[model samples]
Target chain A: MTEIATRDAYGKKLATLGEIYPEIVVLDADLSGSTKTEFFAKKFPQRFFNMGVAEQDLMGTAAGLAACGKTVFVSTFAIFATGRAWEPFRQSIAYPHLNVKICASHAGLSVGEDGASHQTVEDIAIIRAIPFVKVLVPSDGIETEQMVEFLAKDSGPCYLRLSRAKAPLVHEASYQFQIGRGHILKEGSTVCLFTAGFITSQVLAAALELSNQGVSTTVVNMSSIKPLDSKLVVAMAEKHQYLFSIEEHSIIGGLGSAIAETLVSSYPKKLVRLGINDEFGQSGSYQAVIDHYGLSTRGILESLKKELKL
Target chain B: MKKRSVAELEDLACELRILILKMVHHAQCGHTGGPLSCIDMLTALYFYEMNHDPENPHWENRDRFVLSAGHTAPALYACLIKAGYIPKDEMWGLRKLGSKLQGHPKLNVDWGIEMSTGSLGQGMSISNGMAMAARLDGKSYRVYSLESDGGAQEGMMWEGAMSAGYRHLDNRVALLDYNGIQIDGFVKDIKDVAPLDKKFEAFNWHTLVIDGHDMSAIVAALDEARLVKGKPTAIICKTIMGKGVSIFENKPKYHGVAPTDDEFKIAMQELGDQ
Candidate 1:
């Protein structure tokens, strides 16, 4: 069954982890219910601390917990979790490479009515700049669940950017994810469609349309942007004539830019970088904003038809 | 461990000042004034109060030191070197290429440093995090942060202060170097942070106002900080900016700017003789 929501998946996963790992602690800036970290809070009251609308203190307290050899999962809105408390993560967590997971919910334009102030599009770029931080944007509910457990077990600072809206479960329950490796779910190499996060599902739909038009394509789930799957991308680019990268964030300095930088330095190809195209997203329903900004599956098909001369 | 005597701590503070000045002079640049003003407090912690070992800085039982007023790194670096935490000669390469000493105090390059702190008003939050972590672990080690009075005006500092007080973080001790001068001008003339004692007390911290220059007073307050069982302690030390240097003392501009060669010679001659 497709999961209710990525936030709901996070709730179930956090509760499961809390049961197994006694050293796991949950910290939320009063967004426990919204972010789905309330699962862990309910299961483990002593281990969970609702920091109450204080992002800076929340980040620091997470750092402190990590220093004491506990796996600390700090949950809040993406904007406040990554923006206001960036320094503490830089100074205290990433610099020290502590065992802290900065789990942020409602990433990108999916954060609906709260508008531009709360929707975090630049988070990937901002977090990717930090030397030792690992950025993870899981494609769906199942991946969010798997990645939370994966990051908790990995002994370093990691960010799990969660989506608020429900998404199609593209991967099977047994699907395992490597921390820095991208998986090529669809394989044929006339052109490579590369992407990450919930948007990868859109890329998959675009690939199906391109296939019927007799243009072969390869699709990659670029889950980890910082330690990108350069080897896989280079191989695909060498095998293909064109490269297409997409995301729910800016085309500048995000997954697309990261892949482009790798390809340009390694194996350059004809590429189209797709997303919000360096503009802030507006406040509206998820579908309205996606349609308004031309970041939908149809947008991907249109961009591909233009690139492939369909 | 035996506590340092008042006269002994006083003489130690003088030695620390002389060492700090020479360390900066070796590099020919550093924020000397603030460091000079805060050395007694730092000396009291490293030399007397805090639980740490130069041999094993990451020791689980060792007390943590977070320098929130990170620009005064020269002073901390000098004291670290003299006390044998960092190599003595590494002091010469303060901000040069590949040197552990960046403009601000960052952690892991050296043993005693717990976090990398450069931007103002940040270390308090980091220190609070570490203290809360220790509390959760049921650890006995205390976390202490040294922050400047002017830097304390950042809203984040108050946020951290509120968190510390609310959590009842008795294991944390934040020392406020109430040195009146910031880089722009006298703190009073620029952005007055006066009525500091009342301000910290209002934040739920046990406030202790004392002479930052007096070694005995600093030691006493640190002793008192240990006595406050369930609440964090904020030691507000009223200090003269550029205290030891005759020409630079009480001058706001000297907060970041170092002395010229002739001025350095005179300052050196005066400090060295004393």
Candidate 2:
């Protein structure tokens, strides 16, 4: 499987789309090189603004540009963009429903050696709480490209959560990504694996192992966390007795929490949430962190086997 | 829009002060001192300086005004009402439930509000964005932002200040309402933002200091702000916290407190119902 960082895909797609949509303006808070917004900045130097490590100003400036009829895209590390400048994001952009796309990169424990401070497991939760914001975490590079294209033509504010590590391509080139829709990777009946972002690839591998072990599992990508695929979640819940949610974020308010809310309200079921507990992440390699947290393929397979008694 | 003379502008400011007092007193919960301090500059911007149309509030080529110190929303409402952007009757609905006249300025361009701001330290960045947008689109319109002394203490204000100065946003002008009083205490006692003019100058802005209450000086400073070619201008307006009514003037207690019934009568008397 080919692997590409979602941020790289976002940068490439955004720069390409910039040629098509001249109205698209990009801003960054001095993390263009890491966030991969450097591509857009380098290509469209005149339209790009490096706000100089000022996340609050980045959000506000994006709102102002959007108010003036520019389709703006602001970028920075997830910790700074969603945590340091949360209010500006909520007040300036989301409240007014401006046409600014906040593409925050380096989300989750995938931030690796940067440790607990830089690794944000709560970006989804905090950003999702803001009204009028569309929260999207793409599963792979192709999906990231498609989302970038979709959001450029779409109106209103959106938060596109991207990761620093390269994600395994879970879909073919012909894959169609849409807002508020879940993509079913593999179908089965006994168990269901609902996952999002980079965690989907690991869940896919775990599901395949479960299939070989005679414990058939279904794989669904719940990328759009805010306007979640409730119908799909309900349908999957009805088809499978063992339902599980996986993410690289905290189990408290991320994809697991979103799915749990959907299930309890519409169709109640027992959900095994596999992700970070109420503890902070530590310094290590990307795979090391995920493996340590039981999010890797083998770790997830073991957890599933233990839960199902298989 | 016809430009008003200095005397007419001063009369308009006095009328606006009366309206502000009425709104604050009716709401019984809104900032009083800051609005009273900034009304003259707001009057000069809406009546004499800004190239905006009340009828066509969304006109693309018009100059943009962002009230950074949005706690003083009454000042904005008074100007919008006078400019005919909002109905004169809406003044009574200030801060009421379901009112467009929110405690903080909400972005309703039809009401002549360019941006939604109440949280301090945001308007400066928004103004810079607007100025950048104007430059990107090849539009020659200017962007003006109103800042209070309390708002200046925010770190994001300096972040935005640096960007505007670095970008050389010549079409941007920021007016600081240097009234010295905040909700807690005098700004100097709490966190001094003195030598503000020198600070903007250091940031590469054309800095000017003038009496905020003087209508002629307000107009002249804004006029001078427009001629500078390569840098944005910062016009620091020295003002009294509550300028119209002598009793409330410089009284920190009146910063967020509404006038009492007895105090309202005295204020109305002092502002003169001419």
DockQ of 1: 0.60
lDDT string for model 1 (A1-310, tens) is 4645677888889899888888898999988989988888888888898888989878777776776678899999988988999977787788878889998999988888778998888889899989988898888877787888887688989888888878888787788888789988799868888888877787898898898789888898988786888998888888888888889888887888889899889987767888877788889999778777767889889888987787
TM-score of each: 0.95, 0.99
**Which regions of candidate 2 fall more than 4 Å away from where they truly are?**
none
Q: Could you tell me which 10 consecutive residues in candidate 2 chain A have the lowest summed lDDT?
A: A123-132
Once model 1 is optimally superposed onto the true structure by TM-score, how far is the C-alpha of residue B210 displaced, in angstroms?
1.0
Model 2, A152-246: lDDT tens per residue? Answer: 99999999999999989999899999899999999999999999898789999999999998988899998988789999999999999999998
Residue-level error in angstroms, candidate 1, position B197: 1.7
RMSD of each: 1.9, 1.0
Give the Å error, residue A88, model 2.
Answer: 0.8
Error of 2 at B190 (Å): 1.0
Clashing pairs in 1: B106-B116
